[model samples]
Target: MFNVPAITWTLTAVLLLSGSYHFLQATKSHQLTDRVNNILHALMNILMAAMLWNLVPSTMLAQIAVLAGAALWFVIQAVARPEFKMLCAGSQGRLKCVYHSLSMAGAAVMVAMMGLATTGHAPAGALPMAHAHHSMTPAAPSTAAATLGHSPGLAIVLTLLFGAAAVVFILLVLRFGAAKTSHRHGTASGRSARTAHGLEAIGAAVMALMFATMLA
Candidate 1:
């Protein structure tokens, strides 16, 4: 069986760091739109982290509502704030555009997984927070991975969704890496690009392993 706790904590850390980077950058720059974007990204990460660690409500209605809100929040952003939309400029930065699109798409997948679990499909790492102090380590909660395989349909669906997401992130890493490599000036932008690429690679690999292990 896969080591669920290890991956859960690792992904949680990655998401927190990524979200913090953008959030802080936005705050410093006084860019309200970027702030909103980063905040939503952070919220999505928290929702996943919560699900992974069983840190939210356990009932189907409660779970579905939270996940639905997270999912709809993305749509709400695009509709309510034209400037915050993920749609990239047509003039330049094709790679950046692709990255943004993939990020949005990946968030959507998170919502899908939560929705599936909300309906009692019980996809891997789908449990919620402990209801009481003593119930934290519910024996059933710890066996999320084993239970995942029991739902063949959800397993296959997750396999495809996360597999494709992994591929997208790999492409994103390449996209960022290429930018870093081609910039021989050793400028501030180059350093930032490299750091971003490193994070992309880690996130891609983590999610890839997660979906692969759960489906297997």
Candidate 2:
């Protein structure tokens, strides 16, 4: 969880919107793999939004397990042979799958970190807003915030990982936007793809910011 209320709400809004978009796409997609991918992304975004407010503490372990499985699913798709028509097929598709794997893995780690931080500090299913939004200064940390801030090494690693991913995704969004103008016939699909990349960029940046705050 983040200390800054504005950042928290902004992330929550973006995640919810992204999750809703992916959920709708999942419902609409005809391809099995695409549907599964969309569903995983939707769940990841929604759960991440919930995490910002420390919602559903009782389901923390379950969330982590599901996200870890989703990560593995993406990894399998990325490594699958071309003969596996149900999985990622081409080089670009596999690369995208790899990114998806990392995203899911990152989400799982985040859930785990929150779970560890919140343990013994709040009752199951309780909303501990104060614990989530406590001052970052060591002198007045809530119990949960104290736990989160102690692991500087892990936080630094996660911050860098998500930051780099955000930069890459933002570049992809720009590239997609530039290409969209040259390909008139693919405008709709191109726009949708760019939107996806933009959402990914935003999500990754949020993750980076949250982890960076743990260093405070």
Candidate 3:
């Protein structure tokens, strides 16, 4: 009844439309990098939606629908932008490489969890309760049902990491937006400035939502 699939579909639609707009701008300017980045961002959003949908207690039909939608989006990205395949092909920075590697690993884990959940093989008690119902249950536990049995230490570590990443994302968005604005007002060329501005705003909104959800 939580209907996570609907939420995911809505988010995916937003990302797809945004990505399409960015892609059009990139084509007009011949900016391959911007196009690639936009496509990747779209793919990431779809994958995230799938991951969230998998977390909800849904029927196998619903889970399959979510997975299929995400997979279709991913395939479109791969076909449209083959260059993204080299994102981590030859990277050599120890910290940066490790960070990206871990991120990908985490995404994989989330996808696998979704699959298991769909098949009813996932660990029990992993779905969050409706906030509206909380007030009616006086003895309800503070910890989310979805996170019950999870290691507190791991949760803390992940919180710190996600928090730091959120900050860095905010800074990058600000810097990118400023650079784009400066270029747009006859100060410089600032190719793909508009796309950067859009991404910055999206990143900020996403971070805010994540922070709020974490607190809740």
In model 3, pairs of residues that clash are: none
lDDT of each: 0.52, 0.82, 0.45
For model 1, what is the alpha-carbon lDDT of residue 3? 59
Model 1 residue runs over 4 Å out of place are 1-4, 58-88, 91-151, 154-158, 175-183, 186-201, 213-216
TM-score of each: 0.55, 0.82, 0.42
lDDT of 2 by residue, 40-86 (tens): 99999999899899998789868988999999999999999899998
Runs of candidate 2 exceeding 4 Å displacement? 120-149, 182-186
Q: Candidate 1: lDDT of 12? A: 78
State the local distance difference test value for candidate 3.
0.45
lDDT of 2: 0.82
The all-Cα superposition gives candidate 3 an RMSD in Å to the true structure of: 10.9
What is the C-alpha lDDT profile of model 1 across 105-181, one tens digit per residue?
55445444544544434433443443242364665543453343245565466556556656765675577667667
Best candidate, TM-score-wise?
2
Candidate 3 is scored at a TM of: 0.42
lDDT of 2 at 111: 79
Measured with C-alpha atoms, the lDDT of residue 1 in candidate 1 is 23
Task: Give the runs in model 3 whose Cα sits over 4 Å from its true position.
Answer: 1-10, 18-41, 55-102, 114-156, 179-216
